[model samples]
Target chain A: MSRLELRHMRKAFGGLEVLADISLRVDAGEFVSILGPSGAGKSTLFQLLTGAEHGEGEMFFDGAPLDDHGRHFAFMPQRDALMPWRRILDNTTLGLEVQGLGRKAARTRVAPLFAEFGLAGFERHFPAQLSGGMRQRAALLRTVVQERDMLLLDEPFGALDALTRAAMQRWLEQMWRHHRWTALLITHDVREAVFLSDRIYVLSARPARVVREIQVPLPRPRDPTSAATRQAGVLEAEILDILLNLQPTKGHDHD
Target chain B: MASSSFNPRQLAGFLAQAAPAVISIGLVLVAWELYANHSGIKPTVLPAPSRVFEQAMLNRDALLDNAIPTIRATLIGFACSLSAAFALSMLVDFFQPLRRALFPVFIVSQTLPLVAIAPLVVLWFGFGLTPKIMLVALVTFFPMLVALVQGYEATEVEIGQMLRAMGAGRWRVFILARLPSALPYFFAGLRISITYAVVGAIFAEYAGAAKGLGIYMLNAKNNFRPDLVLAAVGVSAALTLVLFGLTVVLQRLAMPWERAAGRRAARKGPQA
Candidate 1:
């Protein structure tokens, strides 16, 4: 189990700041989500968290400062980013292979997860042969195989169709319940944040700062037909209202 | 997968596809022979196709002797060029400053005329196999080098970033992503370079050689035997065709995914 804390994180590119005073926390075995406007520098926050880009911040894991970011967290970027030349099995084993694992051993470990990930018969198929949903599932498998303490998922379902995205969200929650790895998801989908997360962080537009943090009291297995689902809807509306109210101030900030 | 017998329908379809080109060549040959016999043109100027074939058959032993040196020189030179280009491209890709400094030099080297340089190479290296090999390597290196470097550069940036996020190093990113992505470009360069290899070898030999098709052509030209010269030309053309076909086969074997994707595209319109 691992806990992550970010305190007063700030990042800029050249003269333009993208993340301003953004702070959040993820307790051990918790699922947290970040919701924001379309161009609110959510990706910059991810880059900072993963050490892909540098930022000014205090980041702690398990009560100790994290000098390095990527070593302890598995990251899934917005795009599936599967290597077209590699087979699905090989692609799924990429993270492990990067960590100095042998090819044969990595293959052995990843070969069984194909069926769990809904990719049983496609071990030999290339990325171009799979549909978008399958590619995302393969990418997810690649991320999970690394066995990191935390997972950084950046808009993992942003490109999926609505129906497929909803299905994948349910499937993801089931996997999260089983594995219970600490996860921080960056997304603009309020309903997705409300449905999957134990807590949600909402950010304002560019040079984003955390405007609100909401605890979701909804129960697990949040079936859309349950009272919990109705509660999620109310919470989504409240978050939407906060974002709508923030828009005028966001425009003035830009000025 | 190995079968002694082919599907008869498949065989018939292939024959049907090739029939027109075969017929056209046959007709041109017959017409050339007839015109040459009727018009009483000098064989030294434009030998009839039948006379050229007969000359080739009569001097088969002599033709084979010279063909050996040309073939040897061409294969050795092409192999050298391919290795050099691959090493140079990989080095340039690994070192950013080297790319800026060396790529322009490679491009500039290609603009020099082979005709002017071939003789100078022969003068420096003498009438041995060294000059012929050097000429061939010089002429065929550029296309492959450009293709390989551009292929390396064209690696999908998002994939590289994702790998980096997963803790992959610079060399690991190159091995797992850039190398595989560059294969198609490498084959494209190979096809372009192959057509030049034989011609470069012949030019090298033309400048100076103890034995080769180029020397045979020169001897025939001096003796005023245009038929023999045409026969040597025919042999070199055949050699080029064989090499080109080999590269295509290599491409097919190296990229089975491309073939599968192509078949899928054909079945379902274009992939988005």
Candidate 2:
């Protein structure tokens, strides 16, 4: 069964529609990326999928309709927004603590993952003590430690420098491979989308609609410097052309 | 290596910072002592530092009795103000409409000169600790409340959003994020309020009380013993300093991070 399905999803803010009739599906352990220009409603779609906002749509997780009472999905926001006052370990364990797990149990669960994510010795360090890349890694650890089957990441590496971002992408790919999560990521960087996804969904400008869904034929555990990465580049250029060529609707130039 | 161990330059820098205040106070005492000796100025008109020190020693028992009442009033009033202000701030934060409705009232109350109301408070509550305590609460509550509300509002939006994304509820966000962020603000307000607590207590005592430094000052003034009045004033100044120092200590305890940061900056010295 597919882990998540979004059907005919539509969203509007006042009179401005952000997403229009968007639909997608993710099978278990599949990785999908939504690529678009800045205001292409990529984030709006993530918000909708995570139930952060209400919209006109039908969303199913594990063949079950998304309801207010259900609590199976986790959303990771764009920014590395760890609480400044909390140590990295406490911040990572916050989700489990909220779910009524005691501190000791949550720490035990997070301890091994800290080493896996290269954050073992820094558990007692507060957010201000960590560098930006380390902070993002801690944020990612927090998201993954929730033990959810599906992860919705919105521009997780968008704020990092190019070199750090490249390193993080490879690290993320390894983590995903190890854990086999059904993941959906939103990004404006076409290269990032192509590098990390099994399939890329191209979104038009807001009131966004999915214009194309391109399946990436690149093999798993992909190297960014290889010929396969070059092929993905060609695919990214094609998606870029579609994004740039898209024109504003009549009298809707405010977008 | 020995020269570096006892660098004259570093010793000179430390002394340079301490020189002005120390010299100015020394000059003032010398001038006062000289004028009192040469001008035939009676000790009643202006107590020499020597006389005030002697008086302080002589009347230690009486001073202690009065100090106890003022200290009690200040502490009780400060505690009441902190609790009341924190609770009100939380209430205002939870309900925007209530904040909107009551915020103007809070501002107006603050604008009413506290000195004008201190007498009226004594009239209502009588010339006891009750009036003094009430006056201090009135003076301290508004600043603490304002600081707390602003602190709560100042929580970083991105941080709040991140916690929410983790499926953490409102109370969890507050306990983990909002409360810790507000500690610095709370301590800042407490510092301001601490100074006011002493002043407000003194003002209330001045308006009607039978004892306290304020009452002592009044009696010394009537008796034309300026030296005693100056001595009382010095005690009050000392009390304010003690209270302010207490706040700094509390700040250190509550936020060792700030103290560590301060030490780091000091060690780094001036950046060129």
User: What is the DockQ for all candidates, taken in turn?
Assistant: 0.44, 0.27
Spell out the clash pairs found in candidate 2: none
Error of 2 at B138 (Å): 0.4
- State the lDDT of candidate 1 residue by residue for B161-207, as single tens digits: 88888888889899988998899899999998998999999999888
**lDDT (tens digit, per residue) of candidate 2 on B3-118:** 75698887899799989989999999999888887888777777688888788888878777787788888999999999999999888887879988998998888898877898
Q: Which candidate is the best by lDDT?
A: 1
Give the residue spans of candidate 2 off by over 4 A: A247-255, B1-54, B259-272
Classify candidate 1 by CAPRI docking class.
Answer: acceptable
- Candidate 1: pairs in clash: none
* Per-structure clash totals for the candidates: 0, 0
TM-scores of chain B alone in all candidate structures, in the order given = 0.91, 0.86
